[model samples]
Target chain A: MKPFGRVVICGVGLIGGSFALALKARGLVREVVGIGRTTASLERARELGVIDRFATDWATALDGAELVLLAMPVGQMLGVMQAMAPHLGPDTLVTDAGSTKRDVIEAIYSNLKSHLEQVVPAHPIAGAEKSGPDAARADLYAGRKVVITPLSENRPEAVARVREAWAATGASLHDMSPQEHDRVFAAVSHLPHLLAFALVHEIAGRANAEQLFGFAAGGFRDFTRIASSHPEMWRDISVANRHALLAELDTYITELAWIRALLSQGDGDSLLKLFSEARDAREAWLAGRFDA
Target chain B: MKPFGRVVICGVGLIGGSFALALKARGLVREVVGIGRTTASLERARELGVIDRFATDWATALDGAELVLLAMPVGQMLGVMQAMAPHLGPDTLVTDAGSTKRDVIEAIYSNLKSHLEQVVPAHPIAGAEKSGPDAARADLYAGRKVVITPLSENRPEAVARVREAWAATGASLHDMSPQEHDRVFAAVSHLPHLLAFALVHEIAGRANAEQLFGFAAGGFRDFTRIASSHPEMWRDISVANRHALLAELDTYITELAWIRALLSQGDGDSLLKLFSEARDAREAWLAGRFDA
Candidate 1:
């Protein structure tokens, strides 16, 4: 496979830096140009070997690049796409690491239609609570799932290129319509984050939460670890994927209501049975009997 | 400190096996006599070095033991206590690893009131999802908190002996009323587990959950890890700690309603600010400022 020359990765934070390292490690890309809002991070990316060079200007990095990765926050991706529009080469393949797809895909279509044919809106289901280049690791995407949301009018070549790039990082790629991707992730990823955030906020607001946390065991720690993630990014995710998020929230609330009714009516048997089934399902999944 | 002549650990599962391992590691017990309902697990415990000897009969294990550790499920602890009362020595230091102190204390007071003074209901706030003897680790209690709920009528010597035993296992001991312990843990531990179970149940009930899980990221996996825990144990927890769990659930529902209102009204700014503060507080806690 011929290596992609002059690849530009905007927003050289954790996802971007890790992607850059993965690309470099697999020899899929050569001469990676990093761009970020902060000079320190770009310098860190260079020092961390995620990029061969750093650029403050998006246009400078995008010029003549065969691959351009928009790794910025979901809210800022639109302006970023517009900023690099003039510099995008005719055949330059662009993709995003945004959690939500419909909005980003719309922004890309609206902002850079000429290059839209060469763009694929994709999300690599990989990350940690930690962020920035310092938290970046080459194996971040290993054994992870990456979803590519392709439009009916999207160039098949562009979609294939994006799939090949993610495959090089040892990720299994799947394709979905933009709407389906948002709706599915809204249930699994976005809603769960909202629930975690809401739970933490609720508990933290309690008068005795500080004291309660003292006795918190492993379960509490594991359940709330993602609650400690970057808020700005999650807030944007919740809003950007609001429709699907709200739908998922409705389902969660319904389930909670049933539990509350059981508890209120002292229906111990049903509550116990509900908890037992869910536990069995999850245990079987963990034990490899069922797919996770 | 002199080693306990013989320590009988009831229910040789995760906590029981862990307790047995810690005692053996510190040379705090001359012999660990494990009693389990299942003969196979007893054999496994002996093989794993979690116990020096094992039997399916609680009476056999409690016969000559100086310390009798009630490490059974909360719901089963009462029946086990009653079953072992025939063989409990007058001077035996009785303690428990039950999470709900109030229930365990009641069980002791009701089932073995004649020797209730020798019982000290304790809850070790450390555990892992991986259950059974195989999951037992000697250092599991290191740096972990253990709460001892001693009533005014309980013997001082009994409390001291239990405290020393847990401390020898490298756990930090704290004192709390049984009521306080239950209330606090409801918020910190029980509520979180219930929420995780409910969330996963809701998602699994959805038409797209199987497909959705295919794109489930690390956040989903981490948040739901506890969902894979033992169902019988968790069901017992929710049933035994019903009042406290209900109270915590009320608080969570109230806060969730407030959040839903905020979202409905499009108050993203306030929501973001609240989330950011929680994120910062949790990050600081993770950095060890919350260590006692």
Candidate 2:
């Protein structure tokens, strides 16, 4: 396969900066040019050796690039894609690293499919509680999973090229429909994050919450670590995936209510039984009995 | 500074067996005897070298023990203490490792104080998700916190002795009233566990929850690790610490309701502000700004 001639990573924050580092370290691309709204991140990415070169000008960064990676927040992916569409090299392979795929896929399919048949929506399931270019690490994608959703309009060559890109980063790949991806993630990724975000907001709003946190043990600290994730990133994911997330939120509330009702009624047996099953399932998952 | 002549560990499960191991390893006690209703665990604890001896007879275990540590289910600590009252050695330092203190302390004060004056109710804030004797580790309490609640009749010498014993195992010690311990723990430890338990239970009860978890990323796995902890242990804790746990549950529910109300009304500004604040506070806490 021909190496990516000049790859452009849009909005080089945590994910983008990491991708930039991975591409440069793996020699997948001869030159990696980063484009972000802010000059600080671009300069930091260059200083940190995440990118071979950096550019604040989108048009200049996209010039002569064979691949364009949308690494901006989900809410801004479309706008970035629109802005860079005019500068698309004749055969540039366009892709994104957004968590939610359906909306982003739709935006690209409707707006850019006429000019490009190389749009492959993908998500690398790798990140930490930290954010920004400084937090990016070259080995972030090692041993991680990357899911790609390709539509009928996507070129087979383009899909294979994206697969090669992720494989070069040492990420295992999976294929699924956009709808299936969103639904599954709503239960596992999106819902859990939303619940954590809400829990933090609730506890922090309490008058004595700070004093309460002073005594916070390891469990609470570990559980709420993700609650500290970037708010704009989470807010976009929540709103972009609103329908499925709302459904998940409703389901969670129902189950919570069931436990609450059992507690209120002093139904020890049911509570015990419910807790036992959950514990058993969780243990199975932890012990590798269940493949989660 | 004489070593404990004999030590009795009730409910020789993970915490109990680990306490036995810690004492035996450090030569803090001459004899470490375990008492539990489960003959299998008692035998296993002895076999694993967690205890020097075993006794199914609670009365026999307590007979000559200078230090009696109740490491049983939170719900059963009171009953066990009452039963062992007649056998408690004179001037014995009685303490417990139950997670919740207010209720346990009240039980000891009301029922066991007539026979023992040095009741130092404590919670060694450590342990793994797994349980039973096989899960016990001698260094389980290393670098962990152990909160002790001293009663009015508690002897200063006894408190110091208990502190030294835990210190031998490298546990940092903290002192608080039973009420303060309970309230603070409700926010930090109890609330997080319940949240995780409830979330896991909720997802489990969903029609597609099993398949959903197959796609669960590392964040979901990390956040819900404690959900895999012993259910019988958590149930007993929730029931025993009902008053405080209930208060925390109420606070959490209120927060959820507030967010739901905002979402329903499409109040993005308020939701964004609340989400942002929570994110900031959590970030600060994770960056080592908090006590945890």
Candidate 3:
């Protein structure tokens, strides 16, 4: 694969910073430019060698860029896209690292109507509890999945170029419709995060919270680890994918209510069956992952 | 503390086997006897040197034993207590590794009325995803918390002996009433396990389960890891602590409903507040644990 002449990353956070490092490490781009809201963050990203240069304005950063990766929060993607649409090079390929795809894709089509063919909405399903430049690493996306929702307006070459870029990061690419992507993530990722946050919030509000937390074991720690995620990021995702996420939450609450009823009725046998099926399914999924 | 003359383990699974290993490693027992329903498991425990002798019958295993550890599922505790009541020596100290205390304490009082002074219910808050004798380790209980619920009928010497035994395994011991112990675990441990199981079950039953699991990342894996726990064991705990677990479940469902209403109303500000509070609480709890 030929290296790009110039690559600009918006938002010098974990995902953006990591993509910059990965591209540089693989020699996939000649120059990497970072754009952020704060000079301190951009400076730190430059100091860490995550990017070759920094700019506070996307208009200047995207001027001559061959590719632009919008790694900002979902709530901010629309504004960034609208801002850069005028300055985007005619041949530039644009993509995003937002967790929710439908809203980002819609924002691109509505705001960058003339440049829809250059936009390929992509979400790299990788992150940690920590964020920002310091938490970024070159191998953050290695062996991870990056789902791309290509609109009919996207040129084949443009989608291929974005796929090639993610491939260079060692991430497996999967193409799906925006709706399917939202539904799948809503069930597996978004819903779980919301549940974790809700659980921690409920426990924290209790009068005996300290006692409850003091006796909490490793299971509690692992189960609620995601509760410590970035609040603004998750809030944007939950609101953007509101429909799919709400459906999942309803299903999960119904399941929990069923379990509660079983316990109330002293139906030990049925509870055992429910738990056994779940355990077997989870173990099989783990085994399949290992085999793959 | 002097070493026990003979220690009989009622079940040779993870908890029992690990206890035997910890006792042997600390030289806290002169002889370790393994008892189980299956001869193959008993033989395996003996082959692994987790026990000096093997017996399928607790009657023979309890003979001349100075301490007996009831390390079995909560559902089986009553029957085992009744069966071993006649065989228990007057000077022997009986302690259990049951996760729930109130039910097990009641079982001891009901089944071993004559030997009430010797029984001290205990629970060790340590475990791995794996189980059985093969998973036994000498340091399984190292630095873990073990709660001991001593009854009014229990002799001080018996409670002290049980405490010393757990201390030899490097576990910190705390004394609490059975009701308090059950409520605390119901909130921290049992409710989390049930929620994990419920989440996995809901996803597994979906029509797009394969796609959901395929896209599930590290967050889902950690949040649902406890769903792979022993089904029968969780069922037993859920049923034994039904009242407290049910209360916690209701509280959690209410919390989820609040989140749902916020999402429905597109109240991103409130959602952010809720998630931020949860994130801060979890981070503070983690920091406190490390500092301790």
Candidate 4:
């Protein structure tokens, strides 16, 4: 296989930086150009050998670039896509590592209409609570799941190249429609994050916050661990996937109300049945981890 | 310090068995007698060295018992108390390791009214997902928090003895009223557990449960981990603390509604603010852990 002669990474952060390192580690890329919002981060990427060099603008960054990975927060995707519209090569492949695909795909369709065939969106289901260039690891995506949500206009070769690029990083490939991707994630990933945030926010705003937190133990710690995530990133996700997320939140509220009624009636036997079903479900999920 | 000669532990599971082990490890108990609803468990507790012997009846178990610890689920506390009332010696200091203090205290007052002076209600804030005699560890309560909700009727010497016993297990002691203890725990511990159980149950009931769980990752795992806890135990805690837990659950529902409105309006700025506040609160809580 021929090497990617020139590749551009727009974020130069964890996912972007790690992808750059993984390609370099495999000798699959000739050059990796870092372009992002902050010069300090690009400079850090350069100094850390995460990229061959840095670019302040897309024109300079994408000039004859064989591939581009838009790995910034989803909120910034539109601006980046619009900026690259005038500079992108006719056949240059573009991909994203956004958490939410439908919204990111919409951003791509609106801004890069003519380049839709070369645009592929993917989500690598791997990350740390920590972010930034320093946290990037070559093995971050190793043995992880990388979901590619391909558009109707996406070129076969372009999608294959994107898949090959991710596969080279040691990730297993999976496919889902953009809508299915968003809906599934909204139910599983996004909803849990929203619930955790709500719980922590509610307790933290209490006048007796200090005293309440003093009694929090392992369960509270694990339940709210995601609450300590980067606020801006999660804010973007919650907003972009708000439609599916809102549906999930509503369903959860209904479930809670049902539990409240049961508790109000002091129906311990019924409550026990619900809790046991949940416990059995969770245990079954654990036991059938990969199969499930 | 005098040893607790003939100490009897009802319901020899994780909390009960570990208490027996912690006491034995410290040479604080001369003989530990195990009693529970099931003969199989009592036999297991004896065989595992969690207890010196096994007794099926409260009458036989309470004979000459210097101290008695009701380490059963809160739902069974009333029945056990009623059975022990006739056999309990006049000076046998009684204490319960129930998660909910108010309900357990009510049971004590109703059945052990004359022994009120000898009964001290305490809660050990340490536990495991696993139960039964096999999960018992000699250091289970080491460096954990044990809160005592001393009844107005409790004698100073009896309260002191209960506190001393818990402290001897290497746990730090705190004091609170029954109402206060139940309220705080409902907000921090019980509510989180209920929310987790509801989430697991909701997803497991869905037609796409297997698919939904297959996509679930770290966040869902941590957020729903407590849903796998003993259903009967959680049922008792939820019912016993239903009053306070209901209030907290209602408060959380209100918070979710507030978030839903923000999302409906696409107010990412407000969402960001809320998320940042939550992140700050979580970080602060972690920093002020012991002090808070």
Candidate 5:
């Protein structure tokens, strides 16, 4: 396959750096340019061979780039899009690795109105608790799922180009409306992250938190592992997808209330039945993933 | 050290079977007699060498036994205590491996009033998502924490004997009042289990549950891992630790509500601050455990 002539990655953090490395490893892009505010990070990324070159300004990197990946926090997407709009080539394909798609799509349409057909909103469903260029891996997206929520104004060829680019990273791609994407991710990802954060906060607020934590074992560790994820990134995601996330929060709170009632009422039989169903569902999910 | 002459283990399942294996591996017990309602499980226990002999009745198992370990579901402790009361030797040292302490202590007092000084209540903070004699391991309790909540009526010798037995398995022991044990565990263990169950139930109840689950990756798996735990065991724990668990749940619910309000109000700064605090605390906890 012919490689993209020049690709600019705007954030140069975990996702962006990983994407650069994956593309380089697969020889899918001719030149990779990393753009970020952190000079040290860009220097490290260049030294790690995650990018062919580095730029502090997106405008400089946007020049002559055939592809651009916006991999920053969701809150910064609009500003970056607006800043790069005037410099983007007419044929440049723009896509993002943002967790939320609806707001990103709206930002593209509002900021890059003339280049609306060039934008593709995407989210690679893969990451770790750690962040930064140093954490990037060439296989970060291998065998992972990527959802592409192409805007209505996006040209079919633009969407195909974005899909093909992600495919080169070995990620399987799926398409959904931005609304559908937000709703699904809100239920599965965002809501769980919030719950993990809330759980850790609750434990920390206790008077005997240190002692209680001393006795906590593997279960508590695994359950709260995601609570160690990047707070700024999660905050942006939670705020950008606030409506859908709030809906999920309401549903989860209701489920918890039901459990609380069962516990209070001494309804052991009902609690057992509910727990059994949950176990069965989770076990089945595990089996499916392993088998797949 | 001289080993116990004969040790009887009621409910020869995970905890009981593991205790038997640990004792046998350490030469801490001369013989282990397994007692349970399931004849097949008892047969399996004997075949696995988790027990030296198997019996259908506690009376037969308790005969000539110098130590007795009650390792059954919390809900069944009272009944089992009452049934084995008349057969227990006056010199027999009794200890239970139930998760909750208060109710088990009450059961010991009500059913074995005359033998109160011999009873010690304990909880080994170790387990797998699996159960049965098949899950037994000699090192299951190694490096784990075991909290012993001795009753006021329990003799110092009885507590020491119980502590020594657990120490034989390489578990570090801590002494706490039954109330203190319950409160600490409710915050760290029971509440986390309940939240895992609730999260799984919430996801399972969604209309797009299968699709949502398909996208859930490592975070979801880790967070819901305990939901795959034995439902009956968790149900018993939840019910037995209801008062403490309820208090923890309220605190957790309030924390969640605060998060919900932050999301609703689009307060990204506060959400970021809260998430950072939680991440810092969790990271500190992880660092402590790993570095310790």
Candidate 6:
């Protein structure tokens, strides 16, 4: 891949910082600039070599920039896009690492309408419970999945440039429509996160929470591990994809109602069949992932 | 702890096999007799040194048995108790490693009425998704919690014997009433397993399951890891503790509705607060577990 002249990362947290480090590791960028809401965070990212320097304004950050990544939470994407739209270069390739694609795409159309061809929305399927610059790793995206949701107005060359940029991070990239991306993620990713958070919150609010958690073993720990994720980041994701997510949540609640019925009726045979099918499905999924 | 002259294990699977192995590890038993429906399984247990010999009948298995541990699914406890009660030695210490307490206590009362004084019930809080003889580990219970829910008709010495036997396995023992035991586990352990299973089943049944699973990452894996647990075992547990589990499910459904309302109303502030509270509670719970 041809190396870009200069790249700017809007949110130099784990995703953004790691992208910067990964690009540098591949020698794919001549120089990287960090931009964020806080000067201290930008300074920390610069000190950690995640970026060469820090820019406080979009005009300075986008000046002569060849590529830009909006890695902030979805809630901040619209405002950031508005801030950078006037300063965006005519040929700059812009992409985002937001969790939701449809919302980000909408934000792009609403704020960066003139740059629609260059604003390709993507989601890197790599997240940890931890965040911030220090949690960044050069290989965080290695062997992970990155999905690109190109807009209808996007130029082929611009989408190719965005995909190639993610490819430099050693991640396998997949393409889908923004609507499909939001729907699939709302089912697999967003719903699980919300369910996890709810479980922890329910138990935490109980009068016998101490007693309950005292007996919680490995199962509870793994099932609720995502509840420890960065709160604001998840809040942004959940709200940004609210329509698709609400649908998925409704479906899951319906499924839970089915299970509640099975248990209430004392249908052990049906329960066993359901659990067995689930186990087989999950086992096959894991096996397929490994075989891939 | 006093060593038993002969120990009888009914199930000869992970829990029972591990119990036999832990006792042998501490030289707390001179011999362990294996009893099961399948001679093949019993033979495997003997060959694995989980037991000294196999017995086809409960009478022979319980002959001169100083201690007996019924470590089978709660669904099988009643039948096993009925079979063994005929031969249970007057001074024999009887206990179990069932996950649910009230059902096992009911089984004890119904089938082993004459042996009530010697029939103690206990639950070792150590469990793995894996099962069978080969999954048995001598240190399975080491540093794990073991809840002993004594029968109201039991001799204090019998309860001590049950507790000491588990203590010999290196587990820290706690005492709770059988009612409390069922309610607590229904929240912490059983509910998580069912939810995981339900989520996996819901997704696997979808037409786009392959696509959804393909993009699933660490969060999804951890969130649904328990879905791959033993189906029959979990079915038994779910059925055995249906009442408490149903209550938990209803409460959780209500909580999900509240979250749904928040999402539908675009209540980002409330959502953030909820997630932050869950994260803080989980962090504190994890910290307390580590400190303990």
DockQ of 5: 0.65
Q: Write the per-residue lDDT of candidate 6 for residues A102-172, one digit (tens) a residue.
A: 88888888999998888888999998998999999999999999998888898999989989999999999
Q: Estimate each model's TM-score.
A: 0.95, 0.93, 0.98, 0.96, 0.96, 0.97
Off by over 4 Å in 4: A1-3, A25-27, A289-292
The lDDT values for all models are 0.82, 0.79, 0.89, 0.90, 0.89, 0.92
The runs of at least 3 residues in candidate 1 whose Cα sits more than 4 Å from the true structure, single-residue gaps closed, are A287-292, B55-59
lDDT per residue for candidate 2 within B184-280, as digits (tens), equals 8877777788778887777777677667666676788878877887887788777766677778787777777776676656565676687789888
Least well predicted 10-residue stretch by lDDT in candidate 1 chain B: B283-292
Q: Residues A82-140, candidate 2, lDDT per residue (tens digit)?
A: 87777776587878899898889878866676754688889888857788889887788
Candidate 3, residue B91: lDDT: 86
**Tens digit of per-residue lDDT, candidate 1, span B74-154:** 989888988888877788888899989888878888888888778888999886777888988888899999998986767
Q: Where's the lowest-lDDT run of ten residues in candidate 4 chain A?
A: A283-292
lDDT tens digits by residue: candidate 5, A145-247: 9998888888999998899999988899988989989998898789889989998887887777789889989889888989999999999999999999999
Checking candidate 4 for backbone clashes, the offending pairs are: none
Best by DockQ: 4
Candidate 3, after superposition: displacement of residue B254 in Å? 0.6
Docking class of 1: medium
lDDT of 4 by residue, A109-202 (tens): 8999999899999998775567889888788889778889999998999999999999999988889998999999999888898899899999
* Candidate 2 residue A89 C-alpha distance from true site, Å: 3.3
Q: List the residue pairs that clash in candidate 6.
A: none
Point to the candidate with the largest lDDT: 6
Better of 2 and 4 by TM-score: 4
> What DockQ does predicted model 6 obtain?
0.70
Runs in model 6 deviating more than 4 A are A289-292, B289-292
lDDT of 6 by residue, B26-134 (tens): 8999999999878888888888999999889988888888899998888889888888888888988899999999999988888999988998899998878888898
Chain B only, TM-score of each candidate: 0.97, 0.92, 0.97, 0.97, 0.97, 0.97
After superposition, the stretches of candidate 5 with alpha carbons farther than 4 Å from their true spots are: A289-292, B289-292
Docking quality (DockQ) for each candidate? 0.61, 0.55, 0.70, 0.74, 0.65, 0.70
Worst 10 residues of 3 chain A by lDDT: A283-292
